[model samples]
Target: MAKKKTNEPKTLKPEIAVGVLGSGSFATAIVKMLVENSKTVHWCVRNEFVKGAIELRHHNPTYLTSVSFAPKSIKVTTDINELVSQCEIIVLATPSIYLSDQMEKMTCEYRDKIFVSAIKGIVPKANDVVAHYLRDNFEIGFRNQAVIAGPCHAEEVAMERLSYLTIATVEDEVSEKLCQLFSSSFIKVEPSKDILGNEYSAILKNIYAIGAGIAGGLGYGDNFTAVFVSNAIREMEIFLEAIYEAPRDVNESAYLGDLLVTAYSLFSRNRNLGNLIGKGYTVKSAIQSMNMIAEGYYAADSIYRTSKEKGMKTPIIDTIYGILYEEKNAEKQFKKLTAKLT
Candidate 1:
């Protein structure tokens, strides 16, 4: 696998078929971005209802409504086998909870094709990152694929906001290929070898985002938030030290940048759910109102569970799980979390 030079412009093939494994906002946004950039994409939607919705409306009305696609521009399917057979590059955009089930049914003929994982959480049952799941299940080598993590918001792409993502892989060829595949006028791609570190940082930020939102919901001032986010970074670093080689700029665009944005941004359902919890809504109520899967909600369980099994300290993740799932008081949990941080 050859390493590609960063920021060096290279020609891209005009006709590339990208397969998207989920019909969620992230998947829709990525596929739509490719088409808007004139790249062909195939997407899999499991239910007949969603397939019909996309065909009739030209958009995934349930997940991402602001962006629409032409019926002929993107191939939308209910059949997983068909999607796998046709795609050159497969993007697993499904949420972490559903990832295992989706992978179980998928049989890829293109073992040599690039597998681009846009999923951002640890798989709960296996406690595995997306890349590891692909490798163990698909028997693909490091050079066969890449993972994209970032501060990117799928909603922003609906407004065509310029965003950046970090592509990390041990194999230089996979990283470079992913960088080229996802790069467009609106999407900027940077490559790194710190795949594990990047994934951990990306996952931890969600837990912290819930904390920030709780603070916001409680009417806490910026002074509190600044300290909170700083400790959040420290906690992330402490965890990553054991699991990864330490990535450059985890506090920058891909890691901390994502944390800041997701923790406070209007587009974050995780933050929103935290806000509701802080405001005294039950987890069930918040989830019902949001009508979405906040990966952070699920990640709290995975994070806390994995940390417990690994003998790692994760007060932030535990605090979040307590509030969202255990029905703990948000203010008390915030206090406990802050005390631990200090």
Candidate 2:
């Protein structure tokens, strides 16, 4: 069963320090959002070079260039130890593949702070989501000051378009506090207690986005695309049942909203990667052509490996894996998948 929202109000502030774990577009956009709202943010980059670029240029020239920033007003740090110690809220915005390595360098003192994960991918090595890593490695709890920020795009922040996010946590107090802490003029925040379904829905939708792109790449029209997304929802329903109660909101904004945008938007690396696969390009060529990170490629292996280990049937995930890494042709794989359902 799902938990209900409480009506208690708490202190909302404009000056809380937020620490982000990556120098990527999403991280930069998050920091920009907080700063625009009058909160201070400290972004953690790997080296002095990326750190210098963001600090000096006021823009992430490498990852999110179109969006300019004036974060000279905030702090930027390269040291992970120093970052975790200073912030009230810690945001993990790194890719899923780099999460374990990043976690190894941080201390458990962050257990007292609130954790907000802006990443959305399944880790292949550990077969776990970003929140699971924080909980298992740092000993964080489900109901204790942890939340998942899902289906938010960094590019939209560059346009200053009004965007919405679902901050999922089990603790009522933490959820209520975060909804205010992260809310801003251009960024609206929605709170939910179903942390489990929120993250899973976000991850699984990316996999489906790749599938949708592959369909588009194959010259499939709106009729086929309609069937594709509908079946994908059924796929999501089966997958979400394993871990969480059905969240209608998950299918509404964060889940389906992200699915449509990423599947069709030119800004989506996952869709671009899928288009390359449909065009007979190898995974190496696809990734090399693009300079951004596509969570679906890494997540494909994670879902495949973990689902196999857990004995879960994920046909869409399996078909995507086959096209990218298994040397299966896209047309052949599509027919195979269609045959199974028919």
Candidate 3:
């Protein structure tokens, strides 16, 4: 069932040291948000070059270069162990594929801290969502975890465009406190308790975005694209219900709004991957051409595997999985897909 929200005031934790564990675009955006309400953030970066750039230039050299930081707003490091030890709230913002390797160095002490998952993809090897992966590996409890999700993109946040984020957690106090850290004049925060629903929605939207890109590459008109997206949302609602069995509406920003933006936005890497495939690039060639990780590529296998195990019928996911993993001809598979959509 959808949880009810009351008019009670949000509780803010004072002097909470928040640490971020990524150097990507989204991680930079998150740091930008947190620093507004914080004096210092403990950030761990894998690349020593990125660490140097942020320390010396106060700007991320690779990702969001235009977004600058203040003189002492961030405390950057290469040590994950050190970062987690200093902060009470640990935000995991690394790409899903690299998460296991990046966090292998950290100690188990972080299991007691509040974990916020900013990765939109599942952990590839384990086929588990970030929260679930952490719970199993690090022994972190669900109440200690929260996820930041929505239609908001890292590029938009870097531009200081008005954006909204949904922070999902099991505890109201966890959500309430984390919202204070993420809220800014340009950034608004919404709290949700539907962690699984929100996380799965984020993962699924990337796959559908790839479908959108493929359609564009194949010379499908806007009329066809519009219909494709409409059917995609209904499919998303069904997938969510089958997986989580919740009474929540999938039309909210965390679900439908997120799916819309990722599927059509120019900044979508998942769509970019699909576009390359649709343009006759081999899957390997298309992936190699992209500068960033396309979460959809890694998530397709996991979500598809899970769906089959549960005996649920998800045509869009199945089609995308067939094209991506099975190396089925994109044109031929999409032609079949076109017949399935309403």
Candidate 4:
């Protein structure tokens, strides 16, 4: 018996077509992983030059220059709305400071699509994580949203080195789909149920990494750094438990692993910014010199303001905020900060 073909459309997996937004190292790395699985990655950078360069040169002229793209592997554009319309999953890798300006250009409804935030910082002014921001503004419920946390760095990913990624989502199907999209010979994917915890851990770790860099800049040795990081993880675990009581392991790669890498890695821009600040460059000067966004710089202020509202005691966060925002002396502030840490 021959099976008859009907006028029916074939159903695809929910997030097979993935779109990426941003023009940074992390965003490029994401497209790298997606290319391994997806036929064509729909990517939206900020402007025409970036779009043209990548399409013409088979490489991003801005970041991750060594990683070339296959011809026709990436469908690059400057229009966010167009990218969203064609893809089932959208990965936001833009820095937090620029997210609002980029998102403002959007005119499409996105609640039906799966959104994965690779951003590790909170949206400024809103003083809220991207999950909440998307929920409030875009009407995308938590179920359709996910987060990508790294212990894995994009530089390492570009090298094809072994790396691990933690994908956090409340929905099991999302985790499964995202896992398949990113899994490769060099990458290992782990799914987590504590989405909020992973997101906050990602944010807080960068702040602590800055503090670690400050300590290094001030000539503090590895001994002090070890203690500082230990306390940072404890602080992160406490904050996570206070907000959401779930069966989450703080020692897992998503939380503590991400913290340690950002704190110590040479590639961490947040720590580099703090090092410059601790070495006596003004926050303004440190930021201007870097030419990259150190998310912790913005996150510190937002977290401090939000914590005050929630009645949370985040001494590390407060200390960093004071140095970065209030123009407090870094040396004096950190001296006072040490007494609060065990």
User: Which candidate leads in TM-score?
Assistant: 3
Deviating ranges (above 4 Å) for candidate 1: 1-14, 108-110
* Cα RMSDs, all models: 4.5, 5.5, 5.1, 4.2
User: TM-score of each candidate?
Assistant: 0.89, 0.90, 0.95, 0.94
Assess each prediction's global lDDT (C-alpha) against the native: 0.78, 0.75, 0.89, 0.89
Clashing pairs in 4: none
Model 2, 196-279: lDDT tens digits are 676777787778888888887777777887788777777776777766666454466766776767766777778888878777
Tell me the TM-score of model 1.
Answer: 0.89
**Backbone clashes in each candidate structure, one number apiece?**
0, 0, 0, 0
Model 4's TM-score against the true structure: 0.94
Q: Candidate 2: count the clashes.
A: 0
Which portions of model 2 show Cα errors greater than 4 Å? 1-14, 246-250, 309-311
Poorly placed runs, candidate 3 (over 4 Å): 1-13
Q: In angstroms, give how far residue 71 of model 4 lies from its true place.
A: 1.3
Per-residue C-alpha lDDT of model 4 across residues 1-342, encoded as one tens digit per residue: 978967443234443989999999999999998888777899999899998899889989988899999988899999999999898899999988778788878888776899999999999856788888888877888899999996978899899888899999888888988998998888899998777888888998999999999999988899999999998998888788777789988899999899989999999999999999999999999999997899998888877777777788888888999999999999999999989989
